[model samples]
Target chain A: MSGRAIVVTSGKGGVGKTTATANIGLGLASQGKKVVLIDGDIGLRNLDLILGVENRVVYNIVDVVSGRCQPRQALVKDKRISSLFLMPASQIDEKDAINTDQMRDLSAQLKEEFDFVLIDCPAGIEQGFRNTVAAADEAIVVTTPDVSPVRDADRVIGLLQSSLGEPQLIINRMSMDMVKRGDMLDQQDVLDILAVRLLGIVPEDEAVVIAGNKGAPVVLNGGSPSGDAYGRIARRILGEDVPIPELNGHNSLAKRLGRILFGR
Target chain B: MTLTELIQRIQHSFGKGGSKDEAKSRLLLVLQDDRLGLTAEEKEALRQDILEAIRKHLKIDAEGFTMEFVSSPTDQNKMHVSAPVQVGRGPANFSK
Candidate 1:
């Protein structure tokens, strides 16, 4: 059977679609699945950098689509996992270099060879957005706890639903302390807006930033709380029955907020 | 803003996973308030205006939901709108 192609997308910028893509792709490969990570952001590509393979990128996705290189030649392998490969996007080329038809065909080709194909989509519902969505079997919408990100995520989910069906949600960079203080929206709040299945909720951990700076994903540190969160998400993707634990310890404070949401 | 004040500002019953019907209901709550002090007919106009804005904001067609304003016996200044939001697809509505 051909593998599944899932796109990591967010309509809003800087919501960590690329970061989640790298981690989840690596996480899946660590499970002994052959995974291929595609940087579908075109001109503003960063998946290569997040995977710490930027220095290794020579041929990109555009090179493959434009028929300049075959898929095998464009593949950048990472030794971190058993068999994880990357298809970097062109940095100098524009978004116009690729379209939905080409992407759809390319994804079908990749799926035949890998166990999983993950595309890190660009922000906004433009050409790059449509191109990534065109090839996916399902989608993962990433969002932060703020208003604008939620709003834009809602917009993206709506688009994905019309084309790709309902997309699972990943609530990233959540501040449990703020949620306890009633300052930031909790996972339930975001689920309220999108009404999508909650895939996983990743808490705000500074270790994520430190790991990113060192060109490593937090999920590599099985002991880190944030890594634990992504690991759960990855297992969930493989159809493991994983329960989302209550992230904030002081549930006492948000108790009132939860009750009020239910009733008097 | 003070942490308490910020919390108070955001402490609305907006998120708790259920259905899109919840969003339509919440949108109605956010659309109109008695502070505007418009007449019933004027309030309906404002409601329609806000509905248009919501459709544009969500990038969805108007058919995503339906809304109607209902009369409230207790508060003359307040109007209640009940809405049922339906996604395009069924249980596949969450992920397909």
Candidate 2:
């Protein structure tokens, strides 16, 4: 079957691109779709750790591209999900370990087997970013509510729009409390600046941190709000019209401020 | 002035606000410049070229020269460049 290859990226670091990739991949696989999560970060691989399959990684994407091992041999199957797998990155090598051509070939080969190929792209618009974006048919731009990340996300969105068309956005780590208090950028603030299709907004939850510490994705835990958000995002990716609920509490002042600043 | 301080001044001119408003305004200004992909050096060079072209006819105050990018009032997607030149009284206006 001709599958979809999507690259999950944020221009800035520490914005939870790997976590989103792991959860979204697991969420899709939970629906019995064959999903392969590829860690395109190369030397700074973390998707395997987030998916709790680090120990299972023997041969990585670099090894597969360098002809040391076949792609199937390099894939580390998910422990809980039967249809989920991970193509881990090479931790020892640099971001240049795999070039654009090699990544495209690998992604195309995997698309024939897996229903979804979720590539966890590295931060910044460097070689790693180029390689991952080059392999994808679609893109998902993840960002937080902060200033630097939002700016970088805007830049990444511009780049993605020129190449892969308009990428859907995932606003991660949104603090509902702060939004209500007018201390943080709400979904409207982010959407106004980015001007992209909103995929999902994962609320700030302690369960995400705990899941990361345990090396298991929060979506596998099944109780956290962030996990539910990821599941909804996966559904949306499958052409389901899942509405993103309003996270901002009814604060008229904040709404006024949003209207004044964002002109929503 | 640094771009951050300029943005803060612009936001302050908008009157009462919160952290969210400040951030959105700041991002709006920054992303406009970012989308243009023009560096400060490029802008300065462009300013110099404009000064040279205008100096052929009218006198210009090079020291009082200012060029900056401001958010457009009508369209959020567009940017307006504000460069206020002080017309020099002296013919040369050179200290040397």
Q: Point to the candidate with the largest TM-score.
A: 2
Query: How does the DockQ of candidate 2 come out?
Result: 0.20
With a 3 Å backbone cut-off (N, CA, C), the pairs that clash in candidate 2 are none
Show the lowest summed lDDT stretch of 10 residues, model 1 chain A: A255-264
lDDT of 2 by residue, A29-120 (tens): 99889999999988887888888888888999999999999999999998799999999999999889888999999999999999999999
The DockQ of each candidate is: 0.05, 0.20
Per-prediction TM-score, please? 0.74, 0.82
Candidate 2 local lDDT, B16-80, one digit each (tens): 24488888888888887898788889877888887777666655666766655554333556533
Q: Which one wins on lDDT? A: 2
Distance from true position, residue A97, model 1, in Å? 0.6
User: How would the docking of model 2 be graded?
Assistant: incorrect
Stretches of candidate 2 off by over 4 Å are A252-264, B1-16, B41-76, B81-96
Q: What digit string (tens of lDDT, one per residue) describes model 1 on residues A71-99?
A: 99999999677599999999999887998
Task: State each model's TM-score restricted to chain B.
Answer: 0.29, 0.53
